[model samples]
Target chain A: MQRLFAIIGDPVKQARSPDVFNALAAERGVDAIMLSLHVGAEDFAGVLDGLSGVRNFEGAVVTIPHKRAAFLQCGSHGRAAEAAGVANVVRKTGDGLHGDLFDGFGMVNALRRAGVEPDGRSTLVVGAGGAGVAVAFALAEAGAAPIQVRDRDTDRCRQLVHQLTQSGYPACEFADDFQGLRLVVNCTPLGLDPADPLPVAPERLDPDCVVADAVMAGRATRLTAAASARGHAVVPGEEMLAGQMPAIWSFFGLPGETDISAAKR
Target chain B: MQRLFAIIGDPVKQARSPDVFNALAAERGVDAIMLSLHVGAEDFAGVLDGLSGVRNFEGAVVTIPHKRAAFLQCGSHGRAAEAAGVANVVRKTGDGLHGDLFDGFGMVNALRRAGVEPDGRSTLVVGAGGAGVAVAFALAEAGAAPIQVRDRDTDRCRQLVHQLTQSGYPACEFADDFQGLRLVVNCTPLGLDPADPLPVAPERLDPDCVVADAVMAGRATRLTAAASARGHAVVPGEEMLAGQMPAIWSFFGLPGETDISAAKR
Candidate 1:
């Protein structure tokens, strides 16, 4: 049977998951395609209810504002989703809809792919929003110690730090500076506009530090470009997206990356 | 913005609308794809409600057991849908979801395309089910006089004949045989199994009569093949489906056939 998947968000035209997953499905000869469904916040519950009735609707990549709503709607959640209080991926199982948070895993996996193991590394996660929270928890789970979180919203930043500490990652704290950080990830939207300043000054960071930007753009963001210019190992937002594809694909119980590659041959 | 469309039915895997509409959308650069949604009768209402909430969901091709349900759910209907009390297509409008039946028009159009104008022709429609009713009404509307409808279920057959008569198609009546019929259409599931007998005896019909089958098969239906073997004009089920594409596309307010060609160039 041909299965259906969707990447659902309010303004869904900007989503790349449909293209990525659909291409992978086609290449692997999987009888499935991921579509971009533009569903608003108000319609989320109804849409979710409706999609559940579709027998072949196997999974969905929840994006943007729907992630939190998706997390709330799931009957069960993975540890990553529970820790982040949000879900970016959802799959239908015999037990019902299962949700998981993959943003942090994606970032961590991307770093690892770049030969920067997050385990035992000092990391700074900028922005206390959904992405930052997810990344911080993921890194913590990966054994990264002394995780520092920063955001313009002091209460939000403090809340994340508090959550981390309460969750037993006692090394987590609120950061005021970039000192001694080996892995610095900007989870803010600062680099979306060319006129915006870099989330953090690359000059203040050590040359060996891995600097990553979460703001996806057509080309390198200002922070990524500056970090690259400073000779620091730079990971753009696309890497995080690319890193999550296999994770999400596996979460859906479709073929894994290795299986897909084998199938391709 | 990209739009979404779906063909909804219980066993939707066999539906060709997705391939047909998706191909048309791609050829016209419409930034849309039609997916097959398998929703059982029990889930139809919830699914329809969910689909309506989708901001980019422009329309759906209703198939099988859901056509009448779609009709009942629609806020408004076109004349064909009203006449048939069923809808094969539904489109979103500012007023709400509007539905229309194109099966009848499709059959008539297919016949016209094959150089057999239905106007003033005496036609016999086998089976008084959804497809039969739709085709009979469409043929009547196309000026095919003295429409004769037949079915094993005498009650159902008489009910359809009554509906046509009540709707001012007084020339319509219950059919007992192929006598005096200039055109004959098989609207039942008779041809689905190769072992099943033909819906009508092709030898009993006039040599100049036209034959059409609504049973979609991998190859020609027995009735159509036998009729064609006897030198009668025959229209296969695929032609009915092909004929409806432009009508359904136009109903959705998408680019028309001529406009699509112009855009393609």
Candidate 2:
């Protein structure tokens, strides 16, 4: 029996999931097909209604705008989805559609795969959006100590810190400045465009710290370049995308352990 | 400046659009990036809100669940999107997002590329889902003399007939069986699995008919295989996916002139 999976969104043409999963599926000899679905907000309910009736479509990977809805739609959700109020993956269990978030898992997996474990490390993270939240939660779970989160929106930073600690990381804190931080992550799109400035003051960065930017600009992002120039190792956004695939495949009940680093080769 | 294109869906990972578009973009000198977005049903408004505020992202390809919403959300829709009451592509303009559907275009392009024009020919399309509607519309627009549509639901067949004529195809009709139809299309998943029954009874198919199955089963679908055994020409679903690239690219304000069939070679 062939398993069917779909990635649904409003403008669904640019999705890489179908190829990624299908590639893995083909390698695994599983008769599975994955397709991209363009779904709009108004049609979300209807699309779900239609998908719910289809037995072959075994799973779905939820993205922006729908992550929160995915959490609510599922009969049950995992702890991370419940905490972040978002879901990056869903599966059709015997009970119903089960939703869970693998965003944090992707982040943690990326860090671990890169041999840069955040456990017990003092970390400084910039930006507090969706990816940032996932990263923060993942770092907390990874045993990172005293992780400092910064965002232009102080409230969001405060909320992330609260969530991180409430979720069981006792060392979470809000950082108004980047001092005494060893691991720095820029999760904002500040460096995606050539015109955008570094998310943080270059002079303020610790020379020995490891920096990672969640932006892909062909080459190193300004933040990554700056950090590298200052003798710090940097992780690119592609690494994060690659790191998330294994968990994603598992989320879909598909086989294949993915190493995003291998994809770079 | 890199051109921005996107595939929007609630769960966007399961999409080949990024690979297809990125490969196309790499082949060209155009600095462009294709990405997937996960948007939820209620988040449609929020997605539009986000798109309006962004600078780099330009156009998007809509997918299932969001097609009807895209049709409703667009400032204006083309004849095909309007006819089907759905859209698979949306180009952002100064006025707003303009919607069109390339599903029909893909089928039309495939037939034209294969030297089998839908115009003035008899077409028997099986299934009445989104793909069927698009194929039917394309055939109707291309001036097919008589088009026959059938679905499990008789009302759906009636609805298709009404929509086809409303779109200016006067010769549209519903048929309970494939008698003298020159073209046979299996738009349903009936032939998806190796075990699934052929959409059409093999003995009922005309040996001279052109059989096309939209279900991609890695080999000829049971319908197509049966057609081949009976000395009929066959079209695969993968061809449809490949054929839609050019028109879809053009609709996105990108160059899709390169034949997608060549990609297979």
TM-score of each: 0.84, 0.52
Task: Kindly report which residue pairs in candidate 1 clash with one another.
Answer: none
The complex in candidate 1 yields a DockQ of: 0.73
CAPRI-style docking class of model 2 based on DockQ: incorrect
Deviation from native of the Cα of residue A51 in model 1, angstroms: 1.2
- Writing each residue's lDDT as its tens digit, candidate 1 over A1-265 gives 5889888886666667777787778777899888878899999989988999999998898876788899999999998788778898999888779999888877887787788898888888899888888888888999888888888898988999998889899555555566778989998878777999878888889777899877766488899888888899988876676678777888898874633222111
* Candidate 1 local distance difference test against the native: 0.82
Q: Using TM-score as the measure, which candidate wins? A: 1
Q: Lowest summed lDDT over 10 consecutive residues: which window, candidate 2 chain A? A: A256-265
Q: What is the TM-score of chain B in candidate 1?
A: 0.83
Best by lDDT: 1
